[model samples]
Target: MASTVIAVLEVTLSWLFANAKGRDAKSFFTRPALANFPEQSITVTSPDCGASGSKLQVDYTQDGTGRFPALQWSAPIEVAAQVKEWLLVSEDPDAPLPTPIIHGIYTAIPASKTSVNTDDFTVVDQAKALMRGGFHYGRSRNGLPYIPPRPLMNHGPHRYFFIVVAINEELDSELLKAETTREQVAEAIEGKVLGWGMWVGVAERKWE
Candidate 1:
């Protein structure tokens, strides 16, 4: 009977300890930078080669789903600096808006990983759901998932920048409320913007 009680206490203690660390890991987005954080390199990739600044068709489809373009990046991105979290941001600079239109805001990408595989919506969605406790996907302007660009008639080709940045600290869910903008995410990771990699993809709409 005494051994049983001890076993229960041990398990309870271990669970408590893990939750405490989890809290710290999830607190990065809310913590302010006390000093400048060092920079570390991270590579962002996509199966869709936009290196020529090519245009991404809005009606594009992949695996029976809206083509969200697969994005891959370097993994275990430890410059051995103060870093843990990563943020995936996609925005269009020329969307006829006051500021660039934000398309996606995904945070808490594990540092011990690589390749987001956005091409597989199921994969990304599963990750988003599992990470609900610590990570979040900020909604776009239209309150949708990572969105592809759709320019108006003759709006010309729009430059969409897909940026992958590493953060020195873990982010908190509270810091990333629904419909959070990239600017806001930037602000949160500003001082601690350890490193980043970006790929620019172009999209245009032609009106006859």
Candidate 2:
């Protein structure tokens, strides 16, 4: 009987420790610089994400094809004539880590464009192809083209943010290279921001 009680205590303690770390994690949207930056808010939309705050379809998740969905955003208020390029970043702040997970970082989207088709990134030489077609794919947190949403089971719903930033000038060559960190991308675009916007999609994994 005493062994049974000890076993229960050990399991309880381990669960508490794991949950504490997740609760302490911070959202990327709440970062001081982004939260305080002065910019116009554009509208972002995805067919896979029916509406803001809606449940993301399984097709776009790790459980499915894990395809990067088509995305569109409103042009910056300042207009294409003044904007040099745009940056698209997707992340999940509810990840049980110190910083949110960076799903993808795509930059150099031509200022004249406001939408990307679903098949854009599936090319053989995605980076070079994207560059020729008007955008480039930067290395994601996993060093892959994209990371599909895969929240921890029983962690409740996680909010995935698709953030878009309009820039006054092209991003530096260094920032567009492989294996770029979120901090580096954020800092490089700091003073160059002309406007920004975001769309949120929620996903949850239930414990079996």
Candidate 3:
């Protein structure tokens, strides 16, 4: 299972490890520190995103800061008690950390609820919408309805992965209601995952 930050250390940690001035073949970078998954790149598409949606080409930008209200999914939910529409945003793992930061953990959306635009970001309206739609909000690491990505300075660019997963079995909603990490969610949905889609956004603070 995956777990999810780091402080301002250096932008070249991984790079420095790769090309140490004096090291033998058995030294650090030559040896594996952890296991990894096979890479599968996700694509993104928007009106301004043009015709292609490859990895760096699909950038997640802010028209201005404090832009925290929108969602555009490509699929609809199936009507079933066991079927749930789940959303999550996770930080990259390479940064020094004990667990990956969880940006969002929303679940149980109404089958008819497809997206949330800027106009729908109000707390009261969102609550009303969720209540009307029978949705549930889950643990967010930052304790906000939503926290825009703010990767630390010198931590290098972080890949914020926003994913929509179809969970086709009943889950422990109680556990997800409190503090939860990305790995916990991953473990919960392991064999129960019906389908999944993903989008990636890069964020970083310029080092002074």
Runs with alpha carbons beyond 4 Å of true place in candidate 2: 1-40, 126-133
Off by over 4 Å in 3: 1-64, 75-84, 118-121, 125-134, 170-184
Clashes of each: 3, 0, 4
lDDT of each: 0.57, 0.70, 0.44
lDDT of 1 by residue, 100-176 (tens): 66676777767655556643333334434333223567767776656666543344556676767777787767655
User: Which candidate do you rate higher for lDDT, 1 or 2?
Assistant: 2
All candidates: TM-score: 0.66, 0.79, 0.55
- Give the least accurate 10-residue stretch of model 2, judged by summed lDDT: 20-29
Model 3 lDDT per residue over 132-177, tens place: 2244445566666455666545555565555555555655765435
lDDT of 2 by residue, 1-208 (tens): 9956655664454455445333213544444446555444778888656777788888878978786666788864555557889888888877767677889878888888887765766545644525434576777778877788977655667788888887788887766655677777777777677667778888876534
Ten-residue region with minimum lDDT total, candidate 1: 19-28
Candidate 1: where is the Cα deviation over 4 Å? 1-41, 50-52, 57-65, 75-82, 119-135
Candidate number achieving the greatest lDDT relative to the actual structure: 2
Reference-based lDDT, residue 146, model 2: 75
Enumerate residue pairs that collide in model 1: 28-170, 29-171, 83-168
